[model samples]
Target: MGSLRFISSPFSATIQDLGREALAYYAIPASGALDKKSLQLANKILGNPLHAPCIEFSFTPGKIEFESATTICLTGADMQFKVNDKIIKLNSIVGIKSGDILSGSWPKLNARCYLAVKAKLDLPNIYASYSSYPNAKIGYNSGANLKKGDQIHWKEIPLNVSLENIKVDDKPFCESIKIKKAPEYHLYSKDITDQLIANEFSIDSNSNRMGARLLEKIIGDKFPELKASVPVLPGFIQLTPSGTLIVILQDGHTTGGYPRIAYIPENELSAFNQNAPRKKFKFKLV
Candidate 1:
């Protein structure tokens, strides 16, 4: 068996794959990697399954120590990973030897990064998935975020072998996020709806995996309200009574009582999730 130990962990580090399926009936959120594109790319570079479990490091992964030799790849935000004193390029296959130390600084452009190893992570298969749902204490390490002194085990892969490095693009995330009218889009007045599509919104600092709250407010003291809770998924934009707009994310609740003003396309959710706090963006209505 092979393993990696965290010397110093990031603010939010969790084991995530594509997420669980057919569990929404029980209100289980689809807790997966926020940047799905980067996660898949990292796995692909390591010649692993597209949905292989990876460590989703948010903000940055301070440092890690390799307990066994293995090949790995990093994707998403550029944290400038380094092995010992040598810098490692992102999105390229690199081999690690026992006692090698990996470290990275805070990411500059995006919010999260993915590290995929060539072997399967020895995590619990809850709901047939390795994704962590921390609210319910559901995955590896009892669904707790990784911290210093923590180690993760994985099946051993061949060592001391040459691996082909894959060429990946510098910028993989989308530049603009597009949204479509939701079921309750007509509930708001034309003026409010226009502001939503025309004005730009900045991400709130309080935002987390559950949702991305926008800093701007469209409605005043009063707005149309949903009579009852409705099924919501990732990317559903909900307008709260406080006039704040929040886009539901991968770990957001299954049902919401707020007005679903607009919905982001599944393909665009990755781009939206990568937007850092206070990052300004305009939604293009399709």
Candidate 2:
């Protein structure tokens, strides 16, 4: 196996894959890449399996040095990626040789980016996945974000794969997200429901993978007490006591007492993944 050493790890770098599937039965959420479509495209370009491990960078970028030549792709946030001082374009595959350096910054348009290599990432799989779940302390490098000086191991490619041979589709990148009404939707009045769809809500500054808060016209006394620690999943829209709406994501808590008004359709998860603070989101009932 060849080693890819991280000379500089971005602020929130982590080894992310398609995450464990069966663990969800135990209430362990699948905390993989928030922008899964991007991750899949990157893998597709490299001819890697859809669930192959990749690097997820947040906020800042990092530097990686390959021990041998390898084919790689970058997707998701268009982070300012560069190889040895030369900027590389996004959504395409590139070949990196031994001694070459790969570095990048967070995308100006999105929050995170996905980096995929040709061969499988040589890491231990827990519960049938290489994805990292920080909350549960499971999978890859102590189940935490990648750090500076970490050496990423991977199976070496037999031959250098050229970017020209890689074919990446743009469909998932442009698809619209769909959301379904949750069980708690009946708790709100029709007026409140109409307001939710008609009005535009801004992404609050205080948001992350766990959930995103939306700033909207307040709705007081709406389901003041729905006290049950029921199951919650990605895209669950729960109302806070103060009437604020919180859209839960991949890393959201397993259960909560708040009333879940709706669930973002699986397709729309990517959009919410990159939603920037102050950006407006409009809901539509299907």
Q: Per-prediction count of colliding residue pairs?
A: 0, 3
Q: Could you say which candidate leads in lDDT?
A: 1
Best model per TM-score: 1
lDDT of 1 by residue, 3-117 (tens): 9999986788899999988888899988888989889888877778889899998887978999999888888888888999999998888889999999998876788899999
Computed on alpha carbons, the lDDT of every model, listed in order, comes to 0.86, 0.76
So what's the TM-score on candidate 1?
0.94
Q: Once superposed on the true structure, which residue ranges of model 1 sit more than 4 Å away at CA?
A: 159-167, 173-175, 219-221
Off by over 4 Å in 2: 159-177, 215-217
The collision pairs in model 2 are 177-268, 178-265, 179-265
lDDT, residue 264, candidate 2: 90
User: For residues 161-239, could you state the per-residue lDDT of candidate 2 as single tens digits?
Assistant: 4558656553333223356789988888887777778777777877766788887755755455676688888889888
Cα deviation of 256, candidate 1, in Å:
0.8
Let me know the TM-score candidate 2 reaches against the reference structure. 0.89
